[model samples]
Target: MNRRHFLGSSGGLLAGLALPTLASAAVAAPSATGSAASSSAGGRGYRPVVTLGGRTLGFRLNNGVKEFHLIAEEVEQEVAPGMSARFWGYNGGSPGPTIEAVEGDTVRIFVSNRLPEHTTIHWHGLLLPNGMDGVGGLNQPQIKPGETFRYEFRLTKSGTFMYHPHADETLQMAQGMMGLFIVHPKNARERPVDRDYAFLLASYKIDPGTRRPDPSEMTDFNLWTFNSRTFPAIPPLLARTGERVRIRVGNLTMTNHPIHLHGHDFRVTGTDGGWIPAAAQWPEVTTDVAVGQMRVIEFIANAPGDWAFHCHKSHHTMGPMGHGVPNLVGVDQKAATAKLEKLFDGQHYMEMGSSGMAEMQDMAAMGSMMPLPTNTLPMMTGEGPFGPIEMGGMFTTLKVRDSLAPNDERDPGWYTHPQGSVANKVDPKRTDGLPR
Candidate 1:
């Protein structure tokens, strides 16, 4: 966190500070509205929806994942064309759903607090039990708002894990609530792969004059993501040239992500639970994952096209903070001004000035004024073969495939393409063959 604790945290200079009015309010909800907020008075009919290959297990909240209470509304469509407006979600868009479960099963949930305060539900790196380890008031109590907790556990370790609001978790995970859970380890063995994707690396910090979506109580986080959209927004990762994929990396912020992938070099094989005995597999090409970490990679899609994964730090691939403001050329403005002048040595980046003025700068000078951006490093980032490189902040990609096939072809017209289909066009190879 830096820019001087992002401006001196209470939610940084009172920009919106309401952690239930500074903690201890525990539970609340009453503003009477639309059918008293349906779901037949607090939902969770609980059902794995369908189950296994039929792929099921649906949930929202039943309670205790660390003081639960997710509920961020504000509808209104049209994401482009005139940019329609009204965004923000939790049970819906802006990164919310994609739960799926398997491993040792059991996964029950219930969380129902239509919003107003008191929240919980941390499950960042799954290994449940200490009261489902959600960490609100340090294990339980806080669900308030409309009250409805019940997070049952049991998925003994899985590949990717994440949930949010461990009570003010860096401003309710920067106002979005965050998501993506996936477990699937009842034995997904069948190597040489085919297709499987799940990514949730994150980062956000935008206030270069209220351009909106900014939440840094100071220090790290400067917008960088995937699954919350960032790099060219979303594209790559499609494979079919020699298939063999399975990319499930996770890194739910606090910073630490070194993920590099101009072409290919994977085979870490499971961590956080599910496979790692094949003589302890290891053949990286650039990995480094910390902060609430996770890894279960496996590549061999034989480079088919559209590469450039990301996060190898270098200013998280660039494109913000005054876009090109004072950058005077390369190596990220001389390594962010020599790591912000070895983190001070001469001080002043926010000793408080820029007006709104004085009396609030001392979380250690707002956390050393600035320099936490080696791609946001906190829960995981990857780069430990010899240390000093962890900047992946969690990444994406791994689309190799030519026949390790298995699209299961589940209808929906198999993904309608027609109108000048371009014969499935492909040609960008380079997981290691060259010619991206």
Candidate 2:
């Protein structure tokens, strides 16, 4: 069978088997209501899906169905504290707004195309009629600029999904046209979570002197983001200790990210296909989210502290940097610096990369003496209590504390450790090596 036919047949077969199980589970579980219930209106009772600097899209009730409105437009967004880009996105922000819905409910999403180009929103990983699957010409007509398109469908299953343009997908998605679409289970009390959060991993390659992101870039991306914001600027996730936490991660970047969380071991609870069976779940401290994929990780917030949550790739933690710089490690530049300094009377040049490369970050954080190219983020930004953190992209902190409010998502500042709980400087005079 061809690809389309295969997908159609598989979708039908899965729906036939899955719908009954989902329905039976709904009947067996007690009806959840109020704040604990998953409702189409207001997403009440559901743990708020944190989007960092972004906001969730709200809906209005029309008869029994939920109605949502979206607008595609050009946006100038700050990817980090020092970098901003002009890109096309839905609503007013890049990565758009989070769309929340409940299973078994019909949702009517009206997308108004205000972008300069025609577009269509493909409901990634959603089960819907082929006609409602918003592919530009394959499934439906393209939503031309200045036109509005409506997609009405019943959510058959609840899971983490995404929405991005299928028309001119390469350029549109690369320019930042995407959003998170979450479907809460009809039987809300089945799997309970105290704190739920979601973020999309997106990367961009903005040429050093330009403010626009290049959609044609397939590799050598410079800017990395979580919901389009870099570390320090990316808001910290706050939670009370002992609470059940769920983090929904979606990767739209060209590369995979091994997201690591300090102080906790989490389980791969769900994926775009739906929740993983309990028997199949695996515990991991780091989970690799691959391109065009979604991963839902869950864990108990038993540790109380500000823990680092970031991509395990060391280079991914840093911001936009020159990839062409020649390796200077172990190279003696003292003579060259001395001659340069003498040539330029009052100038002093500092050699780098002998002891370590940390000084480069220190210099960048102190503000480069020379102005950086437009739309480029400093390779290292954000200050820590001790000194410069020397990190930037795809980084944030998961702050778990006993004193934090259950629903509080604000930054609680830095953690204060008890006396003797933190590492201290050691004296060399008192230390004697037993073995060389």
Candidate 3:
């Protein structure tokens, strides 16, 4: 879709997430000076090739981020005994792996297309070389099936970024094929927080009639999720009360998402790699994640209830099964629906009965029986700690358990201790610390 189409399709800019026009960014033309330099630097560069399917495609991991291969392949997963459908994935699953690296590190990624159609991988919200931006045929050409493309750049700045097919982005991304990239800072902080969690929040637009994904439909973003699965299917982000927690957010949708967390206003520490000191950090009840953007915030899990964290876009918290258009049938069907309505009587987005009630009822009905797939927080749709509205299918609880030891039992918000904190990670100041 063109720029106009993307923005307009979302019914104008999402409340507070309007982007500066591309013209204002002055990116309409490539800098001749930089292109010349990038060309010369291209030769003899470390050719890091990753095989796509069976063909080895080459790429270079320049700065520090290790280059990996991202392939969009179609896989058939058994959702039921005899029910199977093709799913789009990166590496292998939807909301791909979390790529952890340090700030100021250069990373390269080789993208190979194995699908039957053309696609591109956009490094959502990453500041990289124009050629590596992954806008098919805009900055570079589309990677046709069986073709290989290299994306090389430095993680000069980092916070949270994601990769997803830019071509037919609405469709490709909706079918899955998204992943996270986290760049750590060279100057590590001695914070007391114990755990770090990266969230891949995405919403899928599924046609209610077919109960399948339809990227072409502009207003059907039906299922909202975290890490591809709904709650119950995913685990909770539990920690002891008063423990510090860091949550990195990656929003890959075309619309902005206001992620609301019940009972806490976490201090935002960083925005896409640049650090805002503690003094500058502010506590907000709801953090806004703009389309194709990233933000990192920290909070103390001091509350004790089953706190709900989900997109404020009411519809996003629902699934296709639950968001059915009301049927103006006979009074019997309507009465049965009215009885079901009592279940969500005091819940959110449950006002205007038929229009809103049918969808949720259908979603709950479908999810109640269908086996939930993965169990990672934030939960994907059709899974765990689901549906009290905000906490329903769209949320997973933060089950904070009291702990005095630094064990896996303790939920370390944003800290990962590998080999005693100096594991495979390298200090950005050191050249040979980690490979680019």
Clashes of each: 72, 1, 42
Q: Each model's TM-score?
A: 0.30, 0.88, 0.63
**Candidate 2, superposed: residue stretches over 4 Å from native:** 1-45, 339-350, 365-369
**Considering TM-score, which of the candidate structures 1 and 2 is the better prediction for this target?**
2
In model 1, what lDDT does residue 366 have? 36
Q: After superposition, how far is residue 200 of candidate 2 from its true place, in Å?
A: 0.2
Candidates' C-alpha lDDT: 0.49, 0.78, 0.54
Estimate the overall C-alpha local distance difference test score of candidate 1: 0.49
Q: Tens-digit lDDT track for model 1 on 155-272? A: 7755656677788666666655666576654554424355565566666665432333555544445556665555333324555666555666667667777777767788788765
**lDDT comparing candidate 3 with the true structure:** 0.54
Model 3: per-residue Cα lDDT over 1-436, one tens digit each: 3222233223222223212221121111111111101011111111111110111111222232334556678755322222233468765556654454455656556666878899988877678889888888799888999987777787776465667777987778777778766555444453334556666776665443333455675554655666665544444565566777777777766678888887788888877545677788888988898876777778888765456677776666544443464654332354555566677683333222345354544554555423333321211233223333323335655555454333243333432223553336667688876666
Q: After superposition, how far is residue 427 of candidate 3 from its true place, in Å?
A: 63
Candidate 2 weakest lDDT stretch, 10 residues: 25-34
Return the top candidate by lDDT. Answer: 2
